[model samples]
Target chain A: MAIEVRIPTILRSYTGGAKVVEGSGDTLNDLLTDLDSRHAGLRGRLVTEAGALHRFVNVYVNDEDVRFLGALDAKLSDGDSVTILPAVAGGAFGFAAAAAIAQHNTAAGRRTPVTVG
Target chain B: MLSIDRSIVDAIVAHARRDHPDEACGVVAGPVGSDQPTRHIPMDNAARSMTFYEFDSMEQLRVWREMDDRDEEPIVIYHSHTATEAYPSRTDVSFAGEPGAHYLLVSTREPDTEEIRSFRIVDGVVTEEPVRILDAGVDPHAVQSYMFGQSPATVDYECSGR
Candidate 1:
């Protein structure tokens, strides 16, 4: 049984719209590396140049958070399910409101929110 | 569509209302193994955008660390829609990483009332669920005391013979 990796909507394009894919490895790092080999550029989105999980990215094994389990070094097993998600803070507040805030913040000389791809 | 305490629902609504046109975001932390959404942690929307909301990275780190110390998990991850219905947007769906969490949405578009909804976002699929609002049943004062880390027994006995 291979590890099942679940991809989030934002990252789906890299997976060819695959919601779930299988990879084999003894650890999360190995699994992600294996996945990147098949799906180019996927690792770049999830990991930083320093080989660490992206600040805005989260990975979970089964139902336990990887951060609590050793992050990328967390061990993996066949049949384990992995999920990836971007670290976003809020939701659904209309685009108009966001635009207004962005404009206001820019005018007020505040740090504008990072625009996620 | 998991069952949640009325207080928890109220807190989320109150937060959304308080933030008004700007987006509000937060999480309900529950006992790690139990998955009960009990503790309310209202977060500051760093984006502070009327149309967008994002957690302040520093605040998120602090709150998440506190949850870990308390052996709690974010069972209900929630945010608000100010000018729209209580539904997850495509952006929201894209960020729904917590598969085990109940993604609760509260809309404060109306001045008179709020519209609240819940969904399970798993594998990029949004599944709306029925929210069973639970009556806490416990004495309000006792619950308050307990939340403040005070002994519930003291509050219960001080108020009445139990």
Candidate 2:
């Protein structure tokens, strides 16, 4: 029931600089809990206070983004591999504009428009 | 200080110009632990906005995996400011998550001139750094001429909103 988790460089400090760590659980949430027990504060960086995945932290279960697979509830099995990557995002806009855009997108009930490249 | 190749700079500027009025974003990967930037990868700006840029999630995943397989890391994370100076905006600082990689900004506000600058944003603090462009035939490892100072070639312009 061992699942391998690949850590991004920015969060490696929590894992004693280990690029890959092993944990076990039936779901992504459980696995993160297991790892957090040893890593300390790592889970806080990936999950928000409301228990949802952080908007800027991307978690992929194997090849699929966990967002499309039930997020924290995403199922996991033995030997599953999870990769955590910090979202590479930004802009030249001011904070007020960003907040306005965010509100507009949320009100429209749509995620930021994305075009696959 | 960020020391990069002239060809790579040209490529980034070209990408920025081609995507004029829209933000362009990309990464330059180098060998693990090597600060030198060698591979230039132009990423799609998913947001595709005049003032914002975000990498396509799937493309980012694939590119990151390829960098991992090649034992490389993102030495430089770059983006263009279509209507502003080559500086990190509040949104840029809030979203900067990479502490080890240089955050490069290219300003295409002026049609005739391109302004480029680099910064290190750690813990929400942005610090500008010098850029040295290595000419072709020059050793990438050897020291080169410093092209820009902290402010770079940015022209004075009035920002409507803070």
Candidate 3:
């Protein structure tokens, strides 16, 4: 059950700059546990304290996304390859100001100020 | 290096222009293990933001499953930068999971100028590469390796009309 797990650049520090590492487990979660034992704190970045996979992390087994399979419980075996990547978010620009202004204008046009009845 | 048809490149740029003011993202799938990108798939940007792009989770699943059924894989993943240069941002590199895929960026910041670039993102490293746009009657397989000192694609590309 020696599976090859590819490490992402941001998380390679835990793996000592190793791009790929070998682990043994029947399930994906188990594989992470096996890897954490050797790598130390590798699993924390991928999984949350509540035991769920971290929201910003994506795990794939053999190129098939684990979320579509069974997430952390996805089955695994020897020769399977696991890849972990962080969720990409954020950039420049703002839609909030325009959206708020539009909403305000629409409200002002749709209703008139009424005195207390 | 990656070789793509001129028509395909045009289609990608067109999509970027059509989605101006909002980021666009999609993929070009090829036969599994072939590494020849041919199929064009324009996907909706889940974020719908000018500065960011995200593949809708459900749409991503459906597209991936469809590709799997067709014995294909995403050989090229593309996105648009509405106001930025055609380069992968830190977020893009952080999310790159396909080591064998070519990452393409198209910038539609200028109305008259569209800057398209290709990159290889593996393990968070972004390396720009030459994109050979094949003209009519020029086979991607037969095109001369115009990229100086760059290795040719591993698989030969045939006209696999969709």
Candidate 4:
């Protein structure tokens, strides 16, 4: 199973100037876990501790957003392409609302008058 | 991932271009079930001429939610272009939150030669979706409304909890 994953602009430094990388795996988690083992801080950057994907970083499997799907557990194909999109900060008020929503949603409690964008 | 009517797009652009050198805003109403989409939602920008956009307030959200309860999910977001076209700017791309909604932009340079465009932005990339102006049918009254401070209804979310 061979696949190509595109690196987002924010995390390019971790991959040492390589915008694209190659990996092989039957499952999305296996591939991402392998990528993290090879690239120091990638996994931590992409997934949260409870296994939910970060909104700041969008991972697309063959142009399909993982957020709308099964996230990291989403299956992959041999020739599928993975695109990593990072939240850009050049624009003012970048991802603060989405990040806040994500942080608040995962806190494990009732609505609590949770603030959302 | 969604499609909306052109007439609604025109209404959104109309309200936005009226703000001319300032910012305008509105909410989009649609069928209440999941995936319901809107062409545009009218809004009032607190920043005014500053042209900055922040979140909507609780009271405002409450009003829209009430309307939404009567209707469907508020699926589209409309904003103005103070000095430019109906295109996405760097700031617009960054502050995008409702990935599930459509973005409508109206250029204010020449209301007569109005422009409208829809977009879906994720992360930092802005993807333009096709949108056309409809029976907006030449309204001198709307033109006059634009000059006055009569902006579309707005919900102030930035100062909601703070």
Candidate 5:
């Protein structure tokens, strides 16, 4: 079962700058494992140490997000197109800082921290 | 350095202003390997939070696929900071995944003046870069300070309310 995977710009290095690469597998995990064989360290970026999909990495089987389709356990078939995209997210403050500030503000009985102008 | 059109910068600033309490995010796509930013695609902030911004997953997929089909890449990834300075915060540094694209930040903290800055974030390292905004229809090589010197009588581009 050959599946075509689209690589994002950030992960292109692992695929030798190729935009698309092919791999084989019956499930998403197996597909990543198959890809890791050819693209060393690629799986590490997509999957965390606990074997779960990285929080900031988004994987889609065709047009559907894999998270909605059993994530890493999602089934795969021949000619399936898998696309990997890094979740584009960030905030004005670090999580710890934001939490601390919120706690301090709450203790002071002040309104929530002003985030916007 | 991120050399982009002045109109595009205005559009970004306008979008940021319109979404004052919430951060606005978007991407500028250009031909592959060409650093020039030509298309401005304003994206929905899925988080819809005052301090954070995230591109909607489904919308991101569609936009990314469109860029891929057009043989283009995200040359500039921009977002607004509602109450902070126009600089990458620790959160931004940690979550930056587009090493090849310019990370443009617009600050709407001040009602009178908006601050804009650009940076290159790679491997958790943030390096500030100079932004050269080129005037529409003007030669890019010409040294014209459209942003600082004076405002154009008429804007050639319209900011889409996407």
Candidate 6:
């Protein structure tokens, strides 16, 4: 059976304004190759030279992460839905200190002492 | 009808603010339908740009197991935005791992000024919903009153180190 891949707005231009596309495949790798063939610049976004799924690209098979399963080679069955979620990370400020303090307070033996000033 | 204890939202916001500049991620767990706070699965993600968040695989898996052990599914997957609009970006929309998951984004860019928004992202569609605000009342961490076990989330590494 064929699966439907929905394209995000940012990448729609590459798909010629077609957000949702149909293709037939039994695995993520095959589906992705077909998608890249039909649309340019798509493959480069997913895999790197080592043939590993670029860490930036996250794929989900029927809402379950393929990364947790088998990455690109993750198997897909007929009618099974697959989602491609490339890790999108871009922003101005970094949330480092706040995360650290929160963790410290939560860690074993590291209590956040109450302070009054 | 979807009631989330205001305290969980506040604590998540505060935590995000504390990590201003980089991205902060966490998991919100409840009874799938409850008024009281459930659990918070704190995690780390490497910041790439102004509007994208990539979580650590090990951390995410660990939290997933933790949530499973508690017999609760992750109801909300949260992250922070440092410079972009609270609205989900094309990138965020493209890779919505959860079709029925509540996607919450807290903009810590306006550090002193807090702006937090919650969204329901499904199949590339992002819908903004009203998040019932809870009064901070007596405790600064008051919202965290019903917090589950503290999993101790720490940033193993960051690019900017901010």
Using DockQ as the measure, the top candidate is: 2
Q: What is the interface root-mean-square deviation of candidate 4? A: 10.7
Number of the candidate with higher DockQ, 1 or 3? 1
Please give the lDDT score at residue B154 for candidate 2.
35
Give one digit per residue, the lDDT tens place, for model 4 in B1-162: 445443455455556555555556765666655444442445545333324544333324444446545655556676766556567776677556556566666656553555556687765677776543334443334221222233334311111111
lDDT of 1 by residue, A8-113 (tens): 6567788898978999899888998999999989988888899988755868787676888898999999999887755755466444565576787789998735
Candidate 6, B18-126: lDDT as tens digits:
5555566777765544433456655655432234456765455455545556666666778887776566666566556554457777766554555666677765666
Candidate 5 docking quality: incorrect, acceptable, medium or high: acceptable
- The TM-scores of chain A alone, one per candidate, are 0.74, 0.82, 0.75, 0.71, 0.79, 0.68
Candidate with better DockQ, 3 vs 4: 3
Please provide, for model 3 over B1-162, each residue's C-alpha lDDT reduced to its tens digit, 9 standing for 90 to 100. Answer: 788777566667767776777777788888888867777788777666667676765566567668767888788899988888777777677667677788888877777777777888877787888777776733454322222121222222322222
Docking band of candidate 2:
acceptable
Worst lDDT run of 10 residues, candidate 1 chain B, spans B153-162
Per-model root-mean-square deviation over C-alphas: 11.3, 6.1, 12.0, 14.0, 7.7, 11.6
Each prediction's number of clashing residue pairs: 4, 0, 0, 15, 0, 19
lDDT of 6 by residue, A22-91 (tens): 7667778888888888897877767888888875555666667787778877887778766554353322
lDDT of residue B19 for candidate 2? 76
**lDDT tens per residue, model 5, B6-61:** 76787677778777778888998888998988888888887666777778889999
- Native contacts conserved, per model: 0.47, 0.64, 0.17, 0.08, 0.64, 0.20
The i-RMS of candidate 6 is 8.7
Considering summed lDDT, which 10 consecutive residues are worst modelled in model 1 chain A?
Answer: A88-97
- Rank order (by lDDT, best first): 2, 5, 1, 3, 6, 4
Error of 3 at A114 (Å): 35
Give each candidate's interface RMSD in Å: 8.4, 5.9, 12.9, 10.7, 5.5, 8.7
Q: Considering summed lDDT, which 10 consecutive residues are worst modelled in model 6 chain A?
A: A86-95
List chain B TM-scores, each candidate: 0.83, 0.85, 0.82, 0.67, 0.84, 0.74
Question: Which candidate ranks first by lDDT, i.e. highest?
Answer: 2
